[model samples]
Target chain A: MPASAPWSAAVGQGGGVLRSVDIGALELEAGGELPTVTLAFECWGVLNAAGTNAVLIQHALTGSTHVSRGDSEEDGWWEGLVGPGEVIDTDKYFVVAANMLGGCYGTTGPSSIAADGAPYGSRFPLVTIRDSVVAEARLADRLGITSWHAVIGGSMGGARALEWAVTFPERVRRCAVVASCAASTAEQIAFSQAQVLAIRQDPHFAGGDYYDGAAPTSGLGLARRIAHITYRSETEMEQRFGRAAQDGENPLHLGRLRPVVGGSFAGRYQVESYLDHQARKLVSRFDANSYIVITEALMSHDVTRGRGTLTQALTRTEGVQFLVAAVSSDRLYFPSQSQELAAALPGDVKVHNIDSAIGHDGFLTEVGTVGDLLRESFFAQ
Target chain B: MPASAPWSAAVGQGGGVLRSVDIGALELEAGGELPTVTLAFECWGVLNAAGTNAVLIQHALTGSTHVSRGDSEEDGWWEGLVGPGEVIDTDKYFVVAANMLGGCYGTTGPSSIAADGAPYGSRFPLVTIRDSVVAEARLADRLGITSWHAVIGGSMGGARALEWAVTFPERVRRCAVVASCAASTAEQIAFSQAQVLAIRQDPHFAGGDYYDGAAPTSGLGLARRIAHITYRSETEMEQRFGRAAQDGENPLHLGRLRPVVGGSFAGRYQVESYLDHQARKLVSRFDANSYIVITEALMSHDVTRGRGTLTQALTRTEGVQFLVAAVSSDRLYFPSQSQELAAALPGDVKVHNIDSAIGHDGFLTEVGTVGDLLRESFFAQ
Candidate 1:
């Protein structure tokens, strides 16, 4: 490995080299076990003598387990905040972050080989958020740990944590649900559907079987562009970008970041660059099939299934202590939804705040506050 | 025209048979001009003695000028709420409801012709909400009206009213802005872009010139489905359509009201049908070029342009009486944005409310309360 490489054993963060570890053919949901399945995970920090301080970090829509640091400068995603004595304090907790069931990364998603050795692609069956949690449950059991000190996440990860508390009530002692809602809002599902369709419609997508041909990068880029806007707040965009123009760059050409009038055929905005970066990064590590797979999973997240409704979902999680927080600027999962989630979970779960200029992405970008909340929530575990 | 058609001139919606009014090339920030423009308009009541009572009824996105006539078996969009003794009280006001510029209606849009008489399609220039108001100003001038008693609308139309006050302050005496915001949120634009791309990706789209072929109707249907969720609230959907299956249709089929598992190979949700209706209606009356045109226009509605910063945008509108309202259930344009808008445009500018189960779309669906607020905003003109 190169000297600048991050820890390859665990994650693709901080310039870390990674190797795929399959958790083959995981069973999930009421219907039956999927004929074939896989789980992808990356880890940081050390497990203590008691082996009791484990934290399972969940991800949001279009996210992976690369929460910072890889083998190179381009390796780490959230490395600025999740390592050493950083906000997440990897030095203290054995952080176990894994890509969900329907995710890309090294997981068995749409890009994974089917029984026929061909990509599952669109042929992959739809997955629910609960199924993702169920797969994670199998991973937890395999890790030889009866219980986790805490299980937490933001956005869809938050949805998984809620499930952890309800479906497997005893598996997680302390739960932190961040910037998420109790149920997928129709508006949210609608938006997710649009993103999925955007990717699916790319000519290069080839109906999700583009393994041999070109990938639907443009469609994926457009999808990421659309989603990136929601991840940020207006104030932050105003302060960070706000119609600012890139100096000396042709507005009509690539890498242009300003609103140049009468410049050329296609003017570029800095915002567009930002979105393109996000989309490119995602497509590089994430599979298009997994993108659709996970999105569909997220849209199906609901705690009220076997349980009657939200109240029942909450009531079912009797003894689980939880920490509920939301980004101040989050638009996708409004802070109110977090508040509602807190109200719905068992026993007046303590609500925390991560005040950030970024919207839903605060959980990833503005990691300091989230780290601090995690610290407080850890003790509650 | 059919007796059920609400759009007929016989219904007194517009002055003459919906005339084909040519529009200018709309300049866009995203690097393209919506080259061709057409506008559909209808005027009801009379242009009284002094022509001072014109209330320009701005329709929401996906809405048209047939606000009160039942042109089909379907009810008029704003039926029972804008006629003779209705809240808008056509008995007293001369209402001029015109399809905004860049719209898909009889107005000039993507489906409209270029100088060569071919559909403008992908060659359409970008049009802004402010641009729409500018185009409306031309119509106002054509009718020799110096000022309007009131300019009213909800959502997109509400945006127009605010622009009218800023651009033609002397011509707009009273403005009623309801369930709207000062600017489009990043979330708002993200959602809109997703819809645009969804339609663009359909293989049948054939670039922007799909007028003669399959027309990418499926993609448009999906886009409409996405937009509909944004327009309404989760609470309303839950109350009205949640988990409740249609009479005989399975959840997977297009006819079902609620989504069902294993119902169709296409994964068509009942909500998908609703979207198809919206997209189909638009396809029939609107052009794909118009969708891009108006959407681009909406995305660029930064009232602060040339006024310095955001504060300046409000400062410039010192004499305007603004009514900033938002649906309690609205998630796309949070009520918080409305608060910001109200604070920015103060004095006689007040913040109103439309408590509904619907989300952002509460602006249109919850008529009674919204109508009351409208009357209060303009003091019955």
Candidate 2:
């Protein structure tokens, strides 16, 4: 029995081995060797000796390669999908989930050690989704994998998958890009800029070098709050929280709202409280510098960069088919983006929509539906 | 030649006299009387020996009673319309423009000294558009005016004019509500909430009591930036500025953007400079606290408050004639608001559309067109 606590989040699979492996030396695209890098991962099921049935799982923003059981948490992320004889079928396939580059987890990220022996932090070079894919490809190469049974990711992970298909097409035979888009919208970029500003403007930030001291938790929390609002629908927010006050205190300082008379409380709105919680959660685990780096990467996820047109950029990939899915209620990565991606691919690739009121987060919550789709896609093989 | 400079903006005629008055020991609506108050006003012509020919002009958001003329500056903000013998015809009728109740300039506002001798700031009680109209009515009563020739204003100012027609229907003979809606839209309120948050969240702001030190300039600047963006169209912004960068040092960085790729200090985005100028101009003349108050006031301009349905709200007035108008380009005070107001208005209240590319600001621009519309509406007199 695993000692890990149960977290019924869709991705959590009950039991899995949490481990880290040093992938030896990896050569970066910039011709630098990153030595002694351990790719932290969580594995579900037996390797079946030959390891030919390996499945690579990608995680989203603020996610980890610890896709299943934690040290003391039995209800693992992706647990439902990866249990014995489940959709991911732990009994049949070995699932390896690895953290992406520039992530704050055990992966080589802004908090990772640089050659100079200091945290990469702000000095971490800007990373593109392609760069993350390249790093992951190196990990794949180290695992003695010339080809994979399948690769999957949602959100930023999905962007990485798209990049993987293009950068190392022959390796990823099948890919699932969920609740994501081929290109970040200008609106997305604008919001990302706001988050960047929020973090940099925090007096405690100290130019991203305050690692030994206070991190920019306030700004990071605010950034997370801002992003969290966008991740859900306005209608949902209104219905769920509306104008209800958090505390009895009126922000307006007019005492209680008094209904038709007056409104009060500074942090009165329930939504504000919701945001407060979300922000706090982010501030706890996310690093300020890593937040900036990862957000910029997300914003710069345009495959069409320097490739002229999207079609041209997409054409660079020659391997596996893809399962393109977008959350129906997602305003950020609207279903239209999925249609565009599907349009760009060869051979009438099917476009799927997950009807969700949860907005962009539907992919994280509607695991059953997503799992079913994954099962169908994999079963077809 | 008048060395003191006429309040009038016209070269050949007077926009009006820019004047001030002291209303001491006057009772207020909510309670006790203020010890002393000074009101700045502008007049198109003489109040007339009989004072019966006076026409009151209400200004809108970011507008003052200074509808025309400046002692030093030749280009008064409203120079395009109000003039000696312009459409309002200062030669025939006396026109009076009063700075609003909660304004920043010379009039009382959040920055005004309170009974305790400190800036009202956040302590200023929440006042609505109706409150504004009531305050103006008091000004009229103090001026010994039984009735005005017409009450005219656009946008929020227009909302005030509508309140005059409904709250004191008999007090207003002719009312022109331009570039405004009957009620604020959910979308409009949402955007305003965002802007308010932007200002309040500024680190420099000490809970609306920044008078002792630096103001929330960054937050206010961001608020103005948002408003400015909404005040213009995407097409216009694209045509006027596009993604061009401003000229600066060899490698200037503006939130991740610099001048052309040539690496020379060539220039910056034309739009960026425009936004910068807009922000700076506002920062120079406006107080953040007053901005908070007025923005909140505008946000609270709901015609459906206390009153019955919108139609019933209009019916509350015993007698009045109304003219409703909205700018074609206005996204905030959408043209549909004008239509709704006009539809609910009993009798044949005329509705006019002022065509301009400047959006809601068009009510302050396209002077020739608005002047013409004003003339037609008030011509019945």
Candidate 3:
């Protein structure tokens, strides 16, 4: 294969050329066989002769492979954290990001067509964090990269990065886990369960097989609304929206006095309106089944599953350097969880603070701070 | 009116005999008329001469007038806190608990028969915290209680108590607002909006007019699941449920490999089971329309709504003794918000802490501590 393949015209912007390579059928963690698995990925910079300068950047739930404005004008979620002259400088290192296995962004997911040429939909088996890491290792092998200098991600992405270090300790030299934990806490599982039920209970969901219909947009939107609240901090929500009414809409008097069947009241508070907007955006861009698939996979995230204690689970990663960080205001992935993850690691790793008020999403929004931390720790020139 | 009418036998575990008095028509704050409002209440102990010893205890959202197991074997939600020999000392203080106006507990609510002889359903107007207070004040008038010696409540109950202090300053001699804020924060409104949406989206809900058909149990259950999470702290949930799987159920292998339309995977985690249990309990006992109405009322719980500022809104309560307390582990109603409320009070009020690891529900669970605080402050012999 050539050093770089032509960009696939499937999805995403010019962060890098979107490409896919079939990783073949594999047994899933839960039980069932995915006859064929196609992993979609994007890359920037060139792999060095030694192939030792490679870095894998994992994306969070609902995140695409686009990491920066590489060849495309569209800014990535972590726009300033990568690319030329950036902290994870493409000029000095070959950076790659892959769409997670149970995702919709050009990856083999619930929305992807199966061997029978029908959308997998609810037929897709449960994909765990370990399974995704296994698939990514194959992608790395196909790309001629024997080892990665570092694997970095935050939130669900952070879980993926941590899984990579644990599952392939010999392959990842360094790993950075930000705003994530070794396992999903009960609260995390509870929140995700609510999201899943919201979609399932949607009239249009039709189980997870609604791809051929109207696509449970309402359910998906409600799920996003619930998830968006978790992604943000209470103080941030209070300060930004407060109890102010949405402009020109008196939540007080907008609804019908005698509401008819299938009719409901409009959101009166600015916060409600804000949540509605967030819900709408996610509903439009993402696929509902993909959301459920990825969310459940995250809910099943336990680095210690079947592996004794957290310390025992992380025993294999002794060879990999670690960077564990947490957002100060994050309620979803509490900072204390980061401390727990760091404490169980092999070395005396210190948990770093992101010093952000943006909550769990701080890992993505605070690009300057994230870049600064990366430069000082892993990519120091 | 008789000292105590026959027990209405409508709802609630026996405390005081549940009795209803038609307060007549009520003009609601949100631009609607509620024709013939019937306020349901239960009282323990006889009213003292001059009615100076009457203490009104407001129930929280979904809570009934059963503040104690008075005349029945069934226990009340706040059973130990208010009884013949308890903190409030029902034997000495004529303690009364009223089911809030948009409540399902024999109160004039969405499920109640309207003037037209049909269930109100969706035609029920939005009842604010102040409106409930007004209706309760009328109940007090019918019972010949000139002024309440003290008015106490927690959570949404606390909001009602605070509103009483502000809306009818002279009527309440002392007010205790526990586990609540002066106004509903933006985050509170956002969470509530999701809940309302959850119920509204239920196909069987039929726009809140489903009283004639199947109840929106699924939607109501989802709403309860969402609310139940907020009612407890993350630490409590983590310590209690963790990621342990439910017995006899492998969340991993329970779902259909090829999921059919409308099918869903069973909850695998103990936390999910806990939430489901909570949902089932609420769905069995509560009305979905009542849940929406009461939740919206709580969402509209700003004491400063029409009033200038929080301080200005609370300016009328100068003569009313204030006891502002917060659950130390509460994420739903933060201690800082309690502090804010205390700081704005006329006197140098100190916010008390109901220190418990149980989170927001600590106000209910830590009854011993709460009773102690009440005895030391308001009900001291």
Candidate 4:
């Protein structure tokens, strides 16, 4: 048996508790050994007598395990969709959300202390989507969830949901992969690679070993700015910011003459201000090494890596009911990619369209539409 | 008359001569003055007694004045389209190409010497499309060309070409604006802003005055990488590079352990290698400050700025014939934008489409299609 340790459970007002479980050493897909993998998770409601009513919700890159506000009064990322009387109906179904490996939210990531008492830092092993799912399965085993009633996620979270179903087909009854593809496309990888380079290029980065020094906030901010552009659609930007200068600031001659670093000239365009705000927010809460780690993991996400063709890779998932969805304006993961994933599935799976001008983030923003789909398909009585 | 000086013209074998002409001190639209404005230009064929046969060609951002292999044995960018018997027919219409203001290729830009005998560097004034056209007009005066048979260009060059006709309606008899728009969209500005930030964040950038020290090659490379992604279509990137690792470079386990800067792991993806090559090439030949200057100029590309609507902006060009074209797969400047431009013109200018899978670069790559349009319309004499 794997060495297991159950840490303190911080119970919240809604009976949701945040917990961490040690799954011991894990051998990564590519190479290297993670001596001890600790997964931090949060759960709501109780398991049924048969222990088959459990549902796993995967979080996207840079997301934490706080899927909904349970103990904490702070609003969760997906608060409305997973509440007591909401679509997922937390009171009825046992819900579990885990901060993915390589994340900094109480998980055993690069920032986590190693056996030798130093932070893993640059020494952290390369982890893939499959590896994270494997770690999640260990957590599932400890919780006595033999088979999940459903698994759902969007964006990189959607990728994890699909991986769970494919890696352990018998463990998942139904899977909803929203606004994601079966694999990371070339364009997707290209964008992710650029982000990685942005952080690594920062002099303060110091080969990811800057735990005691000044954080690479500038590089992280730059990376966030780049990613934020991809998350939203062109039409949305055009409608919202449309070449308008930021209030009380002119991005013209005087602005150009000023240096950008500490000067007020950076926020010339309203769109630049929006991007700057996004970058600042992410830098404040997120870790740069975690960003790079998760980004690289997402880059290594191809469900068909060693499993032949996409059809062949998904052959094991014949028993799983699938819900594939795409945002209409998502330039990152195009709708056609979702169609390709659906077409490659074992059975006749139809791709649900979430009509949104918000681009890739629509899966997260269009909660009403997503909740409706989940209620009608996976959670209906 | 402008205080003009004809610098020595370097005549190439194909009879193309590279020359610089002083257009004197000029007032800028953005509250500054360029004490002395010199424009670098190149010419092919010969001017007739009428001088109306002179056809002005505008180059895009980072593009040089060498439109064809004239005296230079090196292959010009648009070599096949403008030789003795080609589409533009240099032999028939005295073809002249000028490197715009704020360019590095022998033109007065940020790298040029100021009145104090030092590089303009960060002190370079903000220049707009109208400003460049005004400077080009003085060059036209020196060449004794009263009217241009046609002013043609693509991408940023297209913006310059359109500005010429609108700014000096009677000087240009015909104009072709290809793969461009009347204004830079919000998304375009967002992307350009990210690139500008990337350069400024570089430790070596030193507020755009790094001429005496190591140049911001890394930051410039990052900027180029960002811009290059926007230049190509997603389908093309997928078809060409599709998750394929570079030869002998595994982007998996071992690659992840390696650091990015000066590390072999950076070129794991074939697409990354391609981008790296592109960045390297641009860094070798182009100045970082020039890139920023031209980019900002493009960002300030609203023809309807001081002018009323787009229709009002083109009101002065009622006498000039217009040819508007768009790349079918262009995502940067959408075809709809080209249609909007064509619709706002005085005449019924049909938006001709250059069907190609290459995306925004199609305007430059699909020479045959562009040449066909020019031959049929602007150069059909």
Q: Which structure among the candidates has the greatest TM-score?
A: 4
Each candidate's DockQ score against the native complex? 0.23, 0.16, 0.63, 0.69
lDDT of 4 by residue, B1-381 (tens): 222221112233254567888889989888789999899998887666666777888999889998888877777777788878899886777788899899999889999999999899889888888899999998888877889999999999999999999999999999999999999999999998888777877788888898999888888888998888988999999999999988877778545656655633643778888888888899899988888888889998999988999999988899999999999999998999999999999978899999999899998899899999999998886
Please provide TM-scores, in order, for all candidate models, with all chains considered together: 0.80, 0.74, 0.96, 0.96
Quote the TM-score that chain A achieves in each candidate.
0.85, 0.87, 0.94, 0.95
Q: Worst ten-residue run, lDDT, model 2 chain A?
A: A1-10
Of 1 and 2, the candidate ranking higher by TM-score: 1
Task: Return the candidate ranking by TM-score, descending.
Answer: 4, 3, 1, 2
Q: Give each model's clash number.
A: 47, 41, 4, 6
Clashes of 3: 4
Per-residue lDDT tens digits of candidate 3, residues B1-381? Answer: 543432221233224677778899999888878888898888887676577778899888889998888886767787788777788887777788999998999989999998788898888888889899999998888777878989999999999999999999999999999999999999999999899889988999987789889999989999999999999999999999888888866667627233434333554688888888899899999999999999999998999988998899889999999999999999999999999999999989999989988899998898888888889989998
lDDT for residue A327 in candidate 2, whole number 0-100: 89
True contacts kept of each: 0.19, 0.00, 0.74, 0.64
For candidate 3, the chain B TM-score comes to: 0.94
Over A143-220, each residue of candidate 4 has an lDDT whose tens digit, in order, gives: 778799999999999999999999999999999999999989888888887788788778888888989898888899
Residue B90, candidate 2: C-alpha displacement in angstroms: 6.0
Highest DockQ against the true fold, candidate: 4
- What TM-score would chain B receive for each of the candidates shown? 0.83, 0.86, 0.94, 0.95
User: What is the C-alpha local distance difference test score of each model?
Assistant: 0.66, 0.67, 0.86, 0.86
Model 4 misplaced stretches (Cα beyond 4 Å): A1-17, A260-267, B1-17, B260-267
